[model samples]
Target: MQAVRGVLAVFVLALVGIVSGGKMISDFPKLSVQQMCELMPADTSFLRPHTCNYWVRCPANNTSLEEGTCAAGLNYNKDLGRCTMAANVDCPYSKDSISTTDNLCANETDGTFLADNSSNDCKGYILCKARRENKSNCPNNLIFNPTTRSCVYTNQYRCPVNGAKTKSPACLSLPNNTRLANDEHCEKYYICVDDILYERECSDQSAYDVVLGRCVSALNATCYSTAKLPPPENTFCTSMGKPKVGYFADDESCSHYYICGDTVNGKHDTNPQHLQCGQGLYFDYEKLSCRERLNVRCTLDRCADTSLTYVNVLGDCQAYARCSGGATVGSGRCPADYYFDERSQGCTPVNHNYVACAA
Candidate 1:
């Protein structure tokens, strides 16, 4: 009866310790090799099986058990009663199950890793478990600028002029030299200068037209000028190249012609030289002299077949005809104070007073 009572008392103590989640022995003595190793069965998790590196019977006389921790890089299998390699210890879940060089959690199989929406914090790997992105967010109404590498508001940023807008909600650069018409005035226009739009008024009571690039009179506006013509070799010169002599009107008066001579000492003579046809007479190349502009008969010649020439009539140098392809197609004109001479086969000054047919 005494032995049974002692056994019953020991069992009752063990049962109480197990049920109350209390350690029966406050401090267990360290175990050495060749000693009994034991593990408390109640202390193990049901999901993850507990392992014991070394176990021992408390006091070396009781049946109650105690467990010791596993060694580094080793895990204990309670069923096998021996320490094993950690790689061989298979857990039910793969979370926190791997090691690596750049990141210890690189091989961790916690959750989905979103590479496109991830932050720089996980530089080499990811450990997010919620399936949402772990992105570093910018402040309210601000966007990340990759060039500046900072968050900036759209309104505060000064984008480049005439550049395409960026993807990160930044301000767009407007095109340079854009023009707009003013609503209040016909003569006034708007021009974008250096990305700033401002009103520009045309001088001299002219209406604005973008195609004409200037203002003109609403009724008597004449936007036509020889200045609008492009110069030779893309240069804005008075004259250049072969066929040494050419003519341009001196202003809107059409009373004088600016003789554009070829390169003399490597420079063009753009200034108009004085030449006059006396009153009651107009220059006529057909007669090769100053004759009346009206009732003038120009005799056609075979020399005109291969060359082009012009004789002035009705007061304009540009008003002329093509002398080519075996026929004089239409009436020709000369410069303001000059006329074509069939004898010379070129333009001559009327002030020379030399007649093609002289006595």
Candidate 2:
């Protein structure tokens, strides 16, 4: 009975031990090597499992955990299901996990890391980034004005008028004394002269008036005379109104006038000059001359006597005559001892006493 009781007690104790071991295992959680390393203190012994290898380490420790090692197990925590350490441990908060937007070395309050946001290192870095991005913050010194953009070493510059690269000493020291020219770098400066830009010179007299202090043409009256005078006879003289008779002046030299002449017979002469007919009127070639036209007679008479019995003597009325009484006359009648003649009714023989002539 004593032996059996001892056996039963032993069984109970073994079962209790097994139950406690299982409960302990159940309370603990698995942890990765990284988690276990993070849990180690800055100053602590890192021991190997079952080999008795131990080493003192600090937060600076960069060692990796051996697989299936007790050192890993020693750092594990069942309650939190992770690892913990007392000192020299790299805490989760100390790890660098900044976003892409943030500067690696920038403090939270300030956005830059150099003096006045300028540093050779920073500049080099920015330039590298710019090159990588295939861009430029400033190109040709003209596209970007550095002064306005808060960059160093750049200002506005313009080309000079005369295209000179260097200015005279007077230009540099005095106001408005500079030349109207540019420097090799195409930079221009204002010249000083009486508080204004000094651009005039002695050689520019033709282009500028020293007395008037203004620009003017060089070909003024002072530099040239009026057109050459015309000849005396050809000139327009008020005294010679009628172009001097035989010597007629050209259209440009003559002045217009009028002349009066005689009227011949009942008609005024239509010619410019009244020359006689019997003297034979002819054109005078020596000077401009004129003459009158001769008078001519008509074949028919315009006036006739209607009371007399007669026929028109002339076919075109060039002349007229009266008819006699008691003649062989009808509507247009003739008088006695006169016959009605178709050509003329002047008294004639009854039988062939008169003959008509071809007028």
Measured by lDDT, the strongest candidate is 1
RMSD (Cα, Å) of candidate 2?
51.7
lDDT (10s digit) by residue, model 2, range 1-359? 77446544543443333222212111111223233233222222232211221222323435544433224433322223234452323222122311211222333232221211211111111111211111112212222222332222223322122322322212221112222221111111123343232223222223322222233444331211111111222222223343222222222211111232343443322333222222212222233342211111112221221233544332222223444452223333345454534334443445332212123
TM-scores for every predicted model: 0.16, 0.11
lDDT of 1: 0.35
Q: Put down candidate 1 lDDT per residue, 136-241, tens digits, no spaces.
A: 2343444334354334455534433334311110000112343433332446554534423344667644566533445666554322221121122322234345
Superposed Cα deviation of residue 263, candidate 1 (Å): 9.3
- Candidate 2: residue 145 lDDT (0-100): 23
Candidate that scores best on TM-score = 1
In model 2, where do residues sit more than 4 Å from their true spots? 1-86, 90-151, 154-359
In candidate 2 the C-alpha lDDT for residue 337 amounts to 51
